[model samples]
Target: MSGKVFLAGAAGAVGAALTPLLVESGYEVYGTTRRLERMDAIRAAGARPVLVDIFDRERLANAIDCIAPMIVVHQLTDLPPGLDPTRMSDAVSRNARIRGEGTANLVSAALAAGCECVVAQSIAWAYAAGAKPYTESQPLDLGSEGARAVTVVGVAALERWVLGVNETGGVGTVLRYGNLYGPGTGRDTPQGASPLHVEAAAWAALLAVQHMKGGAFNVAEDEAEVTSEKAKREFGWLPDMRLPAQAAQ
Candidate 1:
């Protein structure tokens, strides 16, 4: 029940937004990145930055130990610049591995550190074909083939790790965010499946630490592929998230 957070991928878009929120929420936040140079802004946002690669299991675990956080947020991804779709074929594979192997490493660290809660970032488009606006109870298309199959494997692995985690120390809440948009985000609303603003996604993570139930909730607008009613009812997830007026200036 202590207010300490270990945040991975702290230099990324969602992490940047979340850092300030964690501080404002009265939680002591520890942020991590692969490069110390990328962490200055995170420090400015009131997080103690630790530079280390998430793929390095020992290094990641040691960093978690040093931080001694009660909560861990897994938002790690290896997206390249410009949100370029041209290179998606390659990026998709890489991202899948992160969701699979990377998630396992994070889960292990969480277990070792005896963290209480784990809130992870996941995609909303992986639900198997159903009526529409797929619910959390719906099945994921893990049986997909080709590149789509590869993507599903990653998504399933990430979620499995996040939701399958035990609740003794803490529970893992998998927030299946819609395609992210808004400030500093790459994919716009019209371009992806059940798109949500980046600010909203960060807000979901912030609220997850405080109010989310330990389960999977879709966080997105009322798009055709997924439904966020659970998040709306449970964590007050806002698909229509926005920037504050002063910050928008």
Candidate 2:
């Protein structure tokens, strides 16, 4: 908590939820955003904002090196606001690129800066159709077609790079999060095969930074498709957590 934390995609839904927690927990938080206009929001959340594109390897690496954070949290995504149906196809491709090429760039940058121990965001719905409650060990839906295949491939790439970082003295922890729904995420209530509150998703990343042992953990509610028991046992992450409506008086 004393050291700095480099948060990628700090203006994102989960990032917006996470920045405040990191600041309150005593970490020097450095957050990234591509849009200059969003810097104020990052600052309001108590994080030093850096403007950089995740796709720009050189710039991102420079940003990371400049901050020299001890922990890196990957929460980048390219989804359209509210997941507009008209924009979903394009967003899917962009999001896939983020999970694949973008993750590679981030990992390279983190390693160069001697910053190990990454807690990355991934989805819980990518598991193949085999069991009722999919565990972390289940194979991804690699054989699927169309958009689902694109998603699975991207998720697989991201996980591989994150976990493989441990081979070179760095540790990678993957939180296979369920569909995030909460304030700032456009969903005030749960929706999807496995719903998760955005606050709980952010909390899971925070817990992983301090307690996780560098592997995949399903972060979801008590859903039928995915199980979060591992995260509960390992990181004490509860899917029911939500941001308080009012500050403590």
Candidate 3:
């Protein structure tokens, strides 16, 4: 398998943390961001950043084709920085669009580029209200309120389009990450099961590139219903997969 990876949303919270890991893993990364300023930092991390938006189908397809990557990892989202809930209603609507419409454009671009594998980030907390910790096969709760309803619908769309890809050479890998925090993200630790640090999230994406396969795996700590047994058994993924915390010192 080729060691080249196309990391869409290369400047995101998870993307920022993942970039260093990609460089260290010796993968030629073609990262994308909507802004040019983000390219400088990405370049510093040994990535070739392409300034393009996921919503632009033509440009997006061209960018991917130019890279000719065997693997595509998507961590795109429209969450506001700091995640203030003052205007959460508006934020939810916009984020939902990213999960739904934005993801659709990515699928089209990946298919047009003849990319074989796609791995994307999905929320773990979007499962239905029945079980304490929802599994991958469980359905999402669509009967939610104003903002939550949009969130569930958007998540459902993103997952469907990613996993629905079928062809002679096409496979989708969805990594359902738990509540992300720590390093570059504002919330260092928040209340949630399956909590994952940004560093671990990055590691999981790299693992996907290393092992190209189809399946949804929960990427999170071994807290309650949030387990990564599938990921651990399949791709050797670990929730605490990080460099030493003292690396900061």
RMSD of each: 1.9, 1.6, 2.1
In angstroms, give how far residue 68 of model 3 lies from its true place: 1.5
Q: Model 3 reaches what TM-score against the true structure?
A: 0.92
Which portions of model 2 miss their true places by more than 4 Å?
244-249
The candidate that achieves the highest TM-score relative to the unseen native structure = 2
- Model 3 per-residue lDDT tens digits across residues 1-249: 336788888888888777777777787888889998899988877799899988887888888888888788889877767766676678788878887888888887878778888889988887777765667777777787767888999888888888876444688888898888886666778547668888888888888877877878788877646567888888998777874444222
Residue range with the least summed lDDT across 10 consecutive positions in model 3: 240-249
Winning model by lDDT: 2
- Tens-place lDDT per residue, model 2, 1-249, is 568999998899999888888887888999999999999999988899999999999999998998887899999999888877899899888989999999999988998998968889999999999977899999999999999999899999999999988788778999999988876677778889889988899989989988747999999888547999999999888887765553110
Q: 1 or 3: which has the higher lDDT?
A: 1
Cα lDDT listed for each candidate: 0.82, 0.89, 0.80
TM-score of 2: 0.96
lDDT of 3: 0.80
Query: Which portions of model 3 miss their true places by more than 4 Å?
Result: 166-168, 244-249
TM-scores of the candidates in the order shown: 0.93, 0.96, 0.92
lDDT measured at residue 225 in model 2 versus the true structure, 0 to 100: 71
